[model samples]
Target: MFIRTENPQTFIKFYPVTVAILVLQIAIWTIYLLPLPSVQMWSNLMTGFNLGIAKGEWWRFLTPIFIHASFSHLLFNSFSLFLFAPALERMLGKVRFFLIYIGSGLVGNIGTYLIMPLEYMHVGSSGAIFGLFGVYVYMVLFRTDLIDRANSQILLTILVISLLMTLINQQVNMIAHIFGLFGGLAFAPLLLNKKSDGF
Candidate 1:
């Protein structure tokens, strides 16, 4: 059975929003990495939000993903966002995709805060990227026709590789990735299948 879906509106769609946010993140990080005082100060501003929830600064949940440790980190995340975000935006539409990204990232940060000590600050878009991965996996499993077997296998392989990379890179917040994956998996099936009669 075909999982009839609408084509995303190319001109007024979620891709632009995702691209804009990622670009802003990259720009902020790039400036922070520079030697300028203004950029440096703005960069350090994130430190105030690092353990925000524990400190009663709840806004940190949203701010953490915008902060990155280094240029290479920001570059890799921006590339991943550029690559995977459009597909998600096209499939889920702008609002849903935005919800998934932000929700998953916030959940990830909360999980990190709960498990890891406050001294070890965590930040990055990896959690949200992993959420995209979880959504892809869910689509492959329950909405099998949405993605073919070959594509599913490829995505799964990539997910495994990404997990391994996170493991090897000790600084990465592996717990956040795990939490985001579970959060996306829990939400994707519910959101994607709402219109269908099948249970």
Candidate 2:
């Protein structure tokens, strides 16, 4: 027996770009994980404080988002990004979505730099994924229809799941997730509004 589902076109349309970007990121990291000198050299480029904005290595802020410590780590993060990003991109448009992704990742890195000791090394896209969740929650909260109610429930569900996951997995960077959420919350209003607010 076949089960009929509501519109799956959204899922189908987004898979290509999301999957391609994530696959490329995974492939690059896989190469970097290899012991080859070339791979090692490439890997060194993403070390947190080794290359940082304070040191004029601004790219490191963004580069770390694409780097993962293990295959499972990469898979989990990439899958989350793939799942949520397309819907956000469709709603916010490519430019806004890209800004949210990069901005949140940078905010996450900044939080790490401030909270963790300088020698501590960290990398993952979880920060950005959390940012996407934050944005979705914000959008849902502002809506006034039945969809809004549904989305609010979804947001609450995600929060509960995040809490559970963080509690269960000590390796997860809960601090980064919190920081990314705050970053997205702070930025969304400014970006979404047309009126100019003096800073």
Candidate 3:
């Protein structure tokens, strides 16, 4: 179910929300990478800095979801979003899917704000992507009817590997990952209720 088979010519026709998000992420990353003083300053201002948030730069929480530290960072998150998000977008429809994605990212950022040190700085969509996994986790555990066995197993394997990587990687913001997961899970019941029949 996670595998994407959408035709390139019509991908945006079917999944406009997912395509829009991908475009936004890439555009933001491009702006960040450009060798321009104004854009560099904007990128710095958008990073998830605990001190900045604490000082009332509240938009930091939302902007960081589209910011990435490097090409690999953008590629990994963007690829993950591309591969997995369309299913949820199609299942949940555009508005609910957008809410879950952004909500989970917000939860991750707010959790980071509360837990991390003032000097801590982070930029990526890992938290939001993990939130998508959390929705899949909810399906595997409680909404089995919404997911088949093979997909469940595959998601479980990925989840385990992701958790292992998160634990092993010293540079990862483990707090955001954990919180983003729970955030997706927390949003699942409300957003997913009565929708299984539709899917």
Best by TM-score: 3
Q: In lDDT terms, how accurate is model 1?
A: 0.74
Cα shift from native, residue 199, model 3 (Å)? 8.1
Q: Give Cα-based local distance difference scores for all models.
A: 0.74, 0.69, 0.89
Over 4 Å off, model 2: 1-20, 50-56, 144-147, 193-199
Structural similarity to truth (TM-score) of each candidate: 0.84, 0.80, 0.96
Q: After superposing candidate 3 on the true structure, give the runs of residues whose Cα lies further than 4 Å from its correct spot.
A: 197-199
Question: What is residue 50's positional error in candidate 1, in angstroms?
Answer: 5.6
Which regions of candidate 1 fall more than 4 Å away from where they truly are?
1-14, 34-38, 47-51, 193-199
Give lDDT tens digits, candidate 1, residues 43-114.
Answer: 655642445567686776777778788778888888787767777776777778888887888778878878
RMSD of each: 4.8, 5.6, 1.3
Predicted structure 1, TM vs. truth: 0.84
Candidate 2 achieves a global lDDT of 0.69
